[model samples]
Each structure stands twice: as C-alpha cells, then as structure tokens.
Target: MSGALQPPSRSGVRIAGDLYQWLVAWHGCVTVLRDQTLRPANPIVAIGVEADGAGNLDDVIFYRAQPPNSYEQVKYAVDSATPVNEDYLLSPSPTGGPSILAKIAAAWRSLTASGSQVDLALVTNRHPDPGDPLIRDRDSRTQLLLPKAGVHGPRSDRGKARQRWAVGAGVSEQELLELLGVLRFDLGRDPQHLRELVQLLMLAAGLRYEDHAIDAGADWVARMVRDGYKTLSLDLIEKAVQDLDLKQGPARAVLSIATLKPDPVADQADWSLDWTDRFDGATAYSKRRPKAPATWAQLQADIEAAPMFLRGKTDIAVTGSLRQAPAFCTGAAFRMVSGADLAILQRGQVWSTSADYEAATPAIVEHSLGQGPDLAVAIAVATDPTTDILRYLRDQQLSVGSLLVLAPPAGGAKDNSIPDASTANALAVGIRDAVRETVRTAPHVHLFLAGPLGLALLLGHRWNRIRPTTVYEDVATADFYEPAFFIDA
Candidate 1:
C-alpha cells in the first residue's frame, strides 16, 4: 500500500499567454463538439499536416470526429481511394489556409477533441466482426490535391482538360497547426514559470484508445523533430523533464509469505454426503432436541456412532512432509473444506510442528482408519521439506489409484504468495506420477490437490488428464478471482 499513485501532469507546450488563452477557448469548443451531438454528419475533423520539400505539403490527413456514417465514409477514404462528399469532410478548412472563422466553425463542429481516426470510427460500433466487409480489401487509389502551379502544356488560356481533383480544397494549414498543438500537449510540452503539466484530460474523463493517442502524438513529435523544429524553449523542456522525473516515483510495502491448510474435518470426510434427510438422519442423534438437548460431545459422539460405508471402497492415499509444524497446523486446522466431509478424530494427538507432523501424519492416518477404513484418502502436506518422503511413498509402489502428493503453499499466511517455481515443478512432477499410477489401477478415482501449491504441483507435472473439477479457497480474501468468473457467457 506504499506505491505512488501519481495523477497525470500537463507540462508540455510553450506559447504566449494570449495564445494559451486562445487554445483554452478553442479547446472548450472542441470539447463541446466532441461530447454532444451537433452536426448530424462529420461533426468534427482532425487534420494533420506534414510539409515536405518544395513546400509541397505532401501529407494531409483528415479524420471524421463523430457519427458512424461519416466516420465510416472518412475511414473508407483514408484506407482506400473512396471518394467522400465534401459534406462529410471533418477538416476545418479544405483549402489548407488560415481563417479565424473556419477554426471557430470547426470548434463548434465536435465534442471530444483527442482520439485516433480508427478509435473514433470504432465508437460507432463495438464488437464489429473481424470478417466484416469493412475490413476486407478494396481496389482504390490514394491521392491528394496540391495548389495549382504554372501551366504545363500549350494553350494555357485556351482549351484545357479539367483536373479530377483540386488542391487546398480538402485541408488547411491552420487546422493542421491546431492539431499539432493538441498532439504536443498530449506528448508533454509545457510553458515557462509553471508546474509541468501532463494532460490527463482524456484519462480523467475515462476515455479509451490511450495507446492510439500516444502513438499519434509520438509520430507527430518525431515528424516535427525531423523537420528542424528542435528549438524547443528551455523552460518548456525543463518542465517536461521535471514532470517525467516526478512521475517515475518509488514504492514501499511490508511483504511476507506463508503457507496454509484446509480444515481437517471437512477435508478428511471419508464419503461425500449432501446436507439432506439422509445426512440429517445419520447425524440426528447428536442434534439438539426440545425433549433431549444435545451437547457438542453428544453431536460428535453421534457422528461417530453412524455407520461409515467406506468399507471396500477404492482408496487413494496422498502423503508428504512438512517443513514447519506450526504453520502447517495453522493452515490445516482452519482450512475450509469442499466436496468432502472432515471430522477431527483425535485433535489432542495431532502434532502442529513440522518434525512432529511429519512423524505423526502416517500413524495418524493409519490409526484413524481403524479396520483399514476400506480405503484411504490421504493428503500429504509439506513445506519446503525434503522430497525423500515423496520418493519413499513412490517407491512403495502404491497403485496410482491410491496415492496423491501435494506441495505446501509458498507463503506462510500472506496473500498472493505462491510456491517458488522450483518447488512447484517438483510437486507437479510428483502429482502427475501419482495421478497416472492411480488412473491405471482405478480409472474413475477422483484426484485433487489442496492449495495453489497443489494445483501447480499437478500442472507442472503435465497431468493434463487430471484436471481439478473444483477449487477450495482456504483464504477467500487471498485467492485471486479469474476474470472469466465475472464475464457473462
């Protein structure tokens, strides 16, 4: 919780106070047009100009700011050579010339001022199919009109062939400059004697297409830099540098890792039983009654009195070593159970230390299953302990249908801490082997691992055939929910 959460700054751009005021005013108009419906088609046009040698101004790109119909038409024009009517033009001025009225008119034309042409088009339709006709290739030509130069052929004033296109009729220089200003501001430029400002207007408003905007801004800056526009005011550059440095801050946190276990009673259920009449009957003797109230001891005693049907059932025994006893005990004692029933057979006898648990688990499992309990569902819990026990269990040549070994969680108790990669790999290999062995003998034997460690243990081993049908969240708060869980199918 000690990480820096810096708000975006706007320390990019250098201009006179009056020009700044004009920019602010123009931006207001741009914002209004971008947010609200005004023009039915081509409400706004963003123009970018790249002047080339011979003052030819080779690049003149125009984007439709709003309305699906216009956006599509403009996109078609840019992507292909599709001719779009003048009415659909978003460019503030088609002539590539300056005009205060034109800028004002253009400002009044749109709402959100900053966005890519593609993003603006997408706004009109989300979830467009990838194979849609709009995405298909089309045969067309790309062209841009330039100012008419001196007459080339003879009969300059006599007969002449009408040109198919006209220059300075589709875009203007003023619109281009305004767009460049917007791009520079977005890329972090600042004025003198003020805190560096990184424009977060788009982010603040929860706008999308951030990558598109950044890319476009970078492209424009690179173009400007290449074109000898490197005389940026020192103050503006300094402010931008300062703003970036401040944004790249540091973080702090109190971090620790811990392992955990599931509740023994629920997890160790010999047979899965639903909470229904049958279960109630089996556990009825211990239920508190109006005539004969029962105590905790009575309830436990009643549960033991009920006949267990685990006799002759196929058994899968899982075993492992524990590196830490108290941690393992804390995890196992409190771990929640699912799809199984757990009951503490002898709480007083269960050891809560690594060495003791390792020494006692086998005997506890063996002793608890009096008369062999027909089959054993053993889960071995371990914390960075030697795999010698795992190897020994494997060497016993127990049928795969009767063995499952899982690794302990990496962290002792802290959240988001998983087992290390190496430990996870070893556990996975062990689990896979166990699963294969089990399936070979008892094909229908259901297999499961306890924690993330357990899951990784199996997965790392590539036991693709043994997938967990359910997961047990011992610490609900610490388990990260997959995004798919929240997605509506």
Candidate 2:
C-alpha cells in the first residue's frame, strides 16, 4: 500500500548523517559540562551515541544511570531544498517499511511500552513547508503536532492527516495525542549551523573553540562508536580533552530567570531565579509596586547576590524571561562597568555583549501620563504595552508624569519584526538611550517593557545614569498591577 518512488542509496549521505550524530553527541557533553545542576553529586552519567541495545532513538541520549534520559533521532538530509511536507512524512520510508511519521510513532510506542520516561525528537535539516496544511498544524513553540479539529466532524486536511497517521500507527485519536505529546520535531538545523552551535557551546564551556578541536573530538567519538561503545563518561571526555589538546579556558557561568514560560535554555545554566509561581497575571502583578517594602528588598537581595555569588566568573549566559524591573536589576548586577561579559538568548540565537552591530532602532514616542515623581516608559517592541500600561495605571490610581514609548513599527511589531540579533540589540540600545535622557530628573521611574528577553537583557546591560526604577507586571484578569523588583538605586 505504498508508492513506487525510492531514494537512491548513497554512502556520502550516510557518512554526513554519522558526522552530524557525533556533533550532536559532542554538543550534549559540552552542555552538561557547562551546567552544574545538570550533573549530579553522585555523577553516574554519560552521553550516549548510537546506544547499542536501544534501537529506536539511540542517536543521541542524555543518559543518566537510570530513566528520564532525553532521546533524539537524527534525520539528516544532504539536500534541504524540499521541505518535509505531509507527503514526505506520510510516504513509505526508503527502506520499504511504514510511513516515516508512522514509524516514528511506532518507535515511541515500543520505547514507552516499558513505562520509561522517554522524550523523542526528530532532528532534521529539512524544514516544515508552510504550504502544507499538516505542516501548519505543527506548533513551532512546542514542536508538537496539534491537529485542527472541526465542530461537527474532522477538520478538512490536517484533521484527515492526523486520522491517517493515527490509523497508520495503529493508535486511536487519544493515543495519538499521547504519542504526539512526548514527540517533538526539531527541524531546520543544517550541518553548518549545528557545527557553529557546537563551536559556540564549546567556547562557552571554556573549551578550545576551534574546528580542529572539534575534528579531534569527532574522530575520537567515531572510533568509540565503531568499537561498540554506548555511552561516554566524564572521565573519558576529560581524557579525550587532555589527549586531543582540548584546552580549558576561562569559563562563563550561566543564569536562568523565568516568569511567563520556562526558559528553553535553562538546562545549560548554573544559577537560576525562577519566579514562575508568581506569574498569576491577576492581582496587579503587572502594575503597581508591591505594597510591602520587604518584597522588593528580598527580591533585590537575591538579584544582588547573584553577581557576587558568581563573582570570579568572567562571563555569563543570561537565559529566561525577566519582566522590566527584574531584567534591569539583573543587568545592573552584571553591568558593563563590572567588566563582566554577558550573552542572552533572544528568540533562538545568542546575542552577546561581545558582539556589536549597527542596525535601525525603534522610533521613540513620549506620552504624558500625569504630574508625579514617577516617570513611566514602555518599551513596545513585540506588542504594544500602551493599552495594558494605561489600564494598570488607572486601575491602581498610580501617579505618572510621563510615559515614553519605544515603538518598533509605530503600531506594533509583527512576527518578523525583530528578525535578527542586530535588530534586537538596536532596539535595546534605543530604549536604554531613551531612559538615559528621560530619567535625568525623575526620582522614581515606573518601567513597563513588552519585548523579547534579549532586549530586556541588553537594556539592563547598559542601564546606566537611570533613577531607581520600579518594574510592573500585568496580571491578565486582575486588570491591576503589582510592582515586581525595584531595580537600580
């Protein structure tokens, strides 16, 4: 019941895929080395490549002695010209077996039959085509297949695709959900991009970030795999590092802070400030400064201690979401004057204080809120914070003399608005400059920001010559405001 077409078997494609697998494995080791929490005190761990007994997702495994290991399947394509549409996933594999998608699901079913905590990912260079309906149902955020459903019946195309996939995998609709839930499609990272990321991770881990270092590592990994080694332990890794001339340099400590959502790069961090529990958008969490002085004091104590705790570390990788005040406070903690190098994850890429670029900044617009010592400024980059900021101010009856708005595209930035790292830095610089000029006379600044984490990190990195600022968080249903951390002095 399959099509007649088949791919021509080639060794080069296979070799390239093998190299990618090694690179992925290399990156995993580097990731664990960079994060303290990722490695346990017991230290019974290793990175798995081509896990010998595990047939399904044995490509790259973040293995512990027991369960909860992250499993990834590498699907490398030499030619990424064609996107992985529904047809591609639904088609029979070149091995003349089940459809690619069905096979993936089947592998999940088989792997999870033993009740092991398994997370599966299909890592590929091919992207999902927007033109395909099934592809549209793939949520990029979670990388899960979310099929469109109809009120009375199944949805036209995507729904049908879902149904077909379920039937093909011998699973019911609900079972399909369970299968899709644990499965993530990690697409669009080509060989070169992966290599670059590997190099960057190496550099961040204080390793000798050279192509030759990687080449030596890759050679060691290939030999290990060929000789039937399943997992590479820390001792083995360090031995390779010593044997292959992989020098250890000055390492950069990583900090992860989250609110709205969990930080994606949290796994690669050393220190973490998790306030996601306080993200209840109701109860003025977004508007007014907390009435209790101790609240701000405690938050500041933690934020201030973070830098001192990481005192001697030459660099820091800031990951996670910090609203306005917390971002600035964190930034101010690791300010430029401290001679601390910093880099933040924006969208998906890394924007660093080490890197500089010239790009167009958002147009600054000033608005008068009221006559008071408190001066409000909204950095409206991703979405317009004006409406929400105004609502919070009115509901809380806060006094504001001025509200400066950093408008990215006048109305608001769309999905493609801050497309690159340079643009993100530009916006942050623009907003920081605006604050520098505006906060000269104001004693207390009410800051409201709507932008990516990178901008927030960047703004705080250079948060100089600004007054003591109170950042507000918006609790959705409450329609009130709660002042978060009061940043700066």
Candidate 3:
C-alpha cells in the first residue's frame, strides 16, 4: 500500500521533511487526551506505536494496558487528489496476505476484549473520498468514510464504498461506524495554513524563537522517534514535562539584525557586507551589561573605535540604547556628533537619525539601470527611522535593473518602536500584491529588503508563497548588503 507513494516536490518542501508525520502523531495524542472518558481516569499508560520493525500499526495512543485507546494510521501525501479508498484498507500484503482493515479489526477486537473503548483515526494530508472522489470540502471527506444512505434502506444495501471494507474485514456496518473516525489535513494547496499548523505545533512544544521554532520542534520529534516510539504523543509530553522541563525555557528577547555591527575582516577588494558579529551592542546598552556604554561620549568613543568600510551606496543606521535604563523608560535621549553617519536606534528621546532625516510615506520608486540581472526591493516601515535607505537606492547606479520601494502610507506614524500586527498585515498584503504585479512584468526579481527584523520575518513568512526570494541583512559600514537567507517557496 505504501510503495505507490510519490516523492515530494523540490520547491515548497517542508523545512524538515518529516515534520508532517510528527504533527500527525501529535494530533492523535491530542485527540485521545481530549476524550473525557479516557482522560479523567489518567489511564493513558503510554501513547506510541509498537516499535516492532514492520511499521504497520502507527500512531498508537494507549490507555491503561493491553490495547490502545486510539490507533491512527498517518499518510502524508503531496498530491491533493490522492484518494482514501476501500482498497487502501482492504488490499492484502503478499507475505502474510493480511490487510490494514484486518489489522484494525484485530486491534478493535483486542481493545473491546480488554473493555476499552476504541478510537481509530485515519489521518492524511489529502481529503478523502470513497464515492465520487473530490478534494474540495468537508462533505466530500465525510463521504469517504461514511457514505449517505439511500431511501430504499441503508447505504450499505445500496453498495456504499465503506460497506465493501466492512465485508472484507468481517465486521458489521455498525461496528465499523463505532470504531472509525476520519481526520483529514488538506495541506497540499494551502502553504500558509501548513506553515501556521507547523508553527502552532512548535509553540505547543514551548519554542518561542520564530526563526528557530521549526528546527527545535523537529529535533523534539526526532528524539521521541529515536527512543523507540514511532510516534510523538502524550509519552513524549510526559518526558518533556519530567526533565525539569528543559523544553520550557524563558523566552529570550528577539534582537533586531540592525542592532549588531558586521564583521570587520572583509578584504578591501570585496565590497559585500556580512553580519558575523555575535552581540547586539544596542541591546547591551539597554541591559546595563558590563562594557556597555553609559554615556553619549562613551558611545561615540565606541563608534569611533568601531571599524568602518567603504560602501557602493547602501545607507546605514545604528539602532539601540546608550545606557542601562528601566524596562519602561523610553524618554532618554542620546546623540553624538561623529565624522561618520551615526544614529541611536531607540524610541523616544534616545531617537536620532542620519542628519536632517524626514519620514516619507508609502511610495514605489523604480529605477531603470539598464536590463541587468540584479533586482532590489527595499522595504521601509515608519517605525524603523531609516526610510532614507529607499532614497539611497533611488540614487545608486549599482547595475540594479529595477528597484521596488515600500514606504509607510502618508500621514502614518514614523519612528514608532513596534509596528502593530494589523498595520503590518495590511502593509504585507499591499507589498505582496505589488510584488505579484511587478513579477509578471519583471521576472527574476532579486530582493534587498531593509526594515525592522520583526517585519522582515513576517515578510519572509508571507513571501515564502512567492518564488525563491533572497533577504539581505544591512551591514552598517559595509559597501554592499549581505545575503542572509533565501525563502524558497
């Protein structure tokens, strides 16, 4: 039954390919826990599949002993049209000539014999259809496991597809109905939904760093699978809860990429920027950490001592605090008259921008630098206080074939600390629409996005729906922007 599975696509692949399997296992465990009859008794002895080599009976969430409380068979399909038919359950294997339905029947019999209620779930990435197969809606999915009855009698009498499986398993229609539950995941077409589900699983696993969440969650799933449980369920949860709950740590503050300076070791011949520094000097100032500048003069000394590089034309800004302040203190001001362009990156009085900087609203400026391979899209929000970067791109003749500028809407608040989600979403939608319109005419569009890191991440999350897009990190004094990562949608 598994041999016919097709390979996954090259693009739009999951970050860690098997995350879907782990998600299926987690959903099964969650389903069993939500069952009041089984949950209150604390009778769930273990929740895992039998690690016996065959890999037949998968996603087992056991309750109190001999038989499992729930048994789920997971299938992650790349195609949305894949069907869940009677043959999938009834087709016999060559060696033992036993079908999945027979195995499910045996499991139900064992559970019933042990006086435990049965909860069987068939989980798949595609929506199932047993009769008049389709992938559109829930109704079609319902028809897969439970066909509508005809007027003359029951649907089974009318030759419903599930009836064939019942006959093949030597079980009555009522018994089959009592044992089975259909759980479908339509993940193939909706990439955003899939990403959100994966993100939710990561959050449930207690990972807060959005960038690191998937990798960490994948590792958690891997540990569960490695320790003899072919599934991730309540057993893994119990373990996560036991070890002083190492999985649950205090969330670390998310530092913006702008808060750190880039590596100073670039060759004079190379103009490319690179962000290889380990610490955010901006954050260091706010926390009053040792070696943090306590005054504007000290900060100036630090900046003067800091390495500077010649750039082709990328505008730069320094963001963060000058001294240790209370968590809520936002009115402190810090400024330094330096030979190089320097600005303190903070909200309120700590505010400073490249000399005589004025905020500009949402506008798109396209430069025709001839038909070159390079395309640059600079995104500037009002909060970042560096919209001048757009102007810089507008002026530069860096063989950039086209330039797309995203600025705040007119009369919008500029230099706000954190851009609100609603505004961010609206801005992202506008930008996505603009990019779609632009890409139709301007193919092979490369990106040189500059904005708050939070907005960068949000853009990354949404733009993953687009083609392979590169994100660049601003290296303060570097000649050119650094290519940080690519979003291969």
Candidate 4:
C-alpha cells in the first residue's frame, strides 16, 4: 500500500528496488501530465527505463528535441542513515565494475563529446556526507560541485581529492568540471514520504490514491518495465491510467494531524502535524496523556494555524490517536461552515462525514442533574465517563442545571456501535440537535465527550447553532478532568 510505512532494509531486495524505480517513474509521469497542479512549466516530456539506446543510465527524461536531456541513475538504499560519500561513490560494485561516479563521468564524457547540451542526475533516497568536503562542496538543491579556493593547488587536500576523482573517472580536472557543471544530485524523500507524495500526485491528476489503485499502478509499471517499454509519452500514460481504472473524482490534499506516534501507515495525506511530543509512548501501539491543560490550548492554536497556512487546500482526511475533546475541537476548528470535504481514516477504513444525509437517525438520551444556569452534555459514544463527568462537575462546582447523557438507540454506544461514516455523522448531528434544544435555555454549556476521535470530529464539524461551549479533556486524570478549548461557535 502506498499509504503504509515501508520496511527499513527488509528482505526481497530485487522487488523492493524495482518497485522504488517504478515509483520514481510514475511520479515523474504524473507531474508531466498537462494542467496537473504539481506539474512544472517545463516538465519532462517523456520517460525512459533501462534505455541503453536512449541513454546509458537507469532512467532517462527526454525533453523536446532542442537540448539538455536528463539521464538519471536511480540508487535505492536500504540503510537511510548511510551517506553517499567519496569512498562510497569511488567504491566499485560487487562484480568489480566501474564506480558510480566513474560510470557517470564516463557517460557524461561520451554524450558531450559532440558538445550537445546534456545533464546527468544521481537520484536516490540518500543524503550526501556533510563531513566529506567533495559532496559537501556541492549545492544540495542544484547538486553541482563547487570546490573551495586552493582546491586545484597541488598538495592541497581538496586538490588531492579532486585528482583522485578525476583519475578514477579517467578524466582531467577540466573534464570533471564539465560533468559537475551540468550534474544534479537529486536526493529525494525517504520511502514512506515518497509514496505519500506519489499518492498526492495521483489525487492531483484525477487518478485514484487508494491502496488497490496504487498497487495496480505499481504492478502495471513493473510489467511495462519488464516488457522493455521505452519512450514513454503522455498518451501512453493516459491509456494506462484509463485501462487500469485509476481515474477518480475531485478531491483536495489531506492534512493529517498525527497527535500520537506518527501515523504507522502510508496515508494519502499531503500535509502533516506530527504531535508525538505531546504524549509519552507506552509501546508501539499505546501512549500516555499530555502533561498539562495548556497543552490543549497549544494544540488548538496548532490546529487553527493549519487552515490558515493551507490556503486553497482545506478538504482533508483526519486520523491518529487524537480523541475526545481534542478531536471535537479539531472538527470545530475546521467546522461545517468551512465548506470543505472531510473524511476520517479510522481503524483501516475511510469514512466521509458528508454521508449523514442517508444515515439512520440515532436516538439521544438526556438527563436533568439539577437546576442551574449552565448545561453539561456527556456523550458515551465509545465509552462511558458519567461517573468521572460527575466527579469533575462536583470538584469544579460548575453551576449546571442538568447533565445530558447522549447514547445510541440501544441505550449503549461503544467504538464498534457506529459502523460507518453515515451512522457516525447521524449520531454526531443527533447529539448536536439534542444539545441545540438545551442551548436556548442555558446561557453556557460544559461539553465532555467520550468517543472515537472520528465521532468527536464529526460532532464538532456539525456543531452549529450551539451555546458558548467549554469542551473538556481528561488530561490530568479520569478523576481530574479539566476544561480545554472554550469554543464559542
């Protein structure tokens, strides 16, 4: 799955390497499509794979006949921390073939023999060694070698290094300079980030970003490569996309608020908020709570800043271990009035909140604790926290007239009760509707939610026509619940 986290140096090197190559090609292919949002103005017009005739490299990017065709050498590294230093580039392959830098220089020397415009790229998921002078001297973005002064002077360390590289490539300093002049060291994102980027590209191209669709695309690309398909064009790619049924409806980029340990899977989210610092990890799957109530305010500010910076991209898929009042506040932050498409990735499935129109209306159960000016609504959609809610109420001495306990029709609500987005949205809206009736009577309401984060978010999204609500979180402890965000809308 493109949305899942890939293994770190897992077994089956052949398949993994091949898949990485295809992913690179597919990314290029998607961006090169006309009018694609991610597309550059001068996108590579065509792609080549194992194209010895086209160019002696792993892949090739052919531009219109004018000049400067790009030859790429794709390197897939199993170890992410491994750096591409002088020793690594100078070292020969297992079969004692020429070193990577030598081969690249040799090809560069050959192609530019006629003085035709050309460029070489070493595309990989590895970074250059910052400590090594040669690799560090080059620009990170341009990847062009820029030796320091006195580099060419005899006996200088940089000079000796340059001489070693020039001798290794069977070329003079001038010849090496020519190669460096046009070379680009394109250090791409790591495996998981790369796949998420690919998915976003697919979404931008009206192509499906679902796991099945991406898998099918990968399989198709692998088959295409095996079949020796060279000179790939847009027409051919469009046909492949159509034949593979990769077309999809409109959608905006997803902003994932990973409040837990990072999302473990490859989700098709473009922007991400990694809030792993908020919690201490118990295991790979379990996490502890935030240290303080101010953390909630900081979280709200963080959530509030997302839409402000995202500009035209607000439609999103919410996921992660963020739950309860925090989740509800997330929905409240990007609420119903935003008019953005919203979905939740929960428990390996994606449920859209917009499907509530066809959902079964859930029954709401309300209670009157006492007569006061304020209201406290305790929802037990995923679990019951009535006892704790009462404890917090008594401890805080909130002037609450009534306490409304909202649940599903069976008078029971747990994580599994709300099966789909439709039911979840219905239940969320039902709770909101039930709260609206009390909003007219009470000047303020204290909202305490206990449910799946998805349900809380949905309720918050539809939470309009409500009172000045102070949403609470069980941050300190279950017995020590505290107020978090004081949302007026």
Task: Please write out the lDDT profile of model 3 over residues 56-159, one tens digit for every residue.
Answer: 44544444443434555555555656465555557786576778677767666654665655555555555445353222223322322333331134443344
List TM-scores for all candidates, in order: 0.22, 0.60, 0.40, 0.61
C-alpha RMSD by candidate, in order: 26.1, 9.2, 21.1, 8.5
lDDT of each prediction vs. the true structure? 0.25, 0.70, 0.42, 0.71
Highest-TM-score candidate: 4
| Candidate 3 residue-wise lDDT at 110 | 59
Question: What order do you get sorting by TM-score, best first?
Answer: 4, 2, 3, 1
Give the distance in Å from residue 269's predicted Cα in candidate 3 to where it truly belongs.
57
Give candidate 3 regions above 4 Å deviation. Answer: 1-19, 26-46, 51-56, 60-68, 78-81, 94-96, 130-162, 181-195, 204-206, 209-211, 229-489
lDDT order, best first, reads: 4, 2, 3, 1
- Model 3 weakest 10-residue run by lDDT: 326-335
lDDT of 4 by residue, 330-420 (tens): 7887788888666665554455666645444455656666757898998887877787888778777789977888887667767788777
- Residue pairs that clash (backbone atoms under 3 angstroms), model 4: 3-266, 4-266, 370-401, 372-401
lDDT of each residue in 1-489, candidate 1, tens digit only = 579855333332122322332222222222222233223234433333232220211122223444321111111111212222222222333575533223322332342244322211111111222232211111111011111211244234211211111111222444432322222111011221011011222221122213343233334334444566422232332343244232221110100111121111121223222222211122333311111242323322332222233332221111121112111222222222211111111111111111111111111112121221112122334332123323323454333323233333332322233333343334444544554444443323222223343332224224344433121112112221111000000
Give model 2's TM-score versus the native structure.
0.60
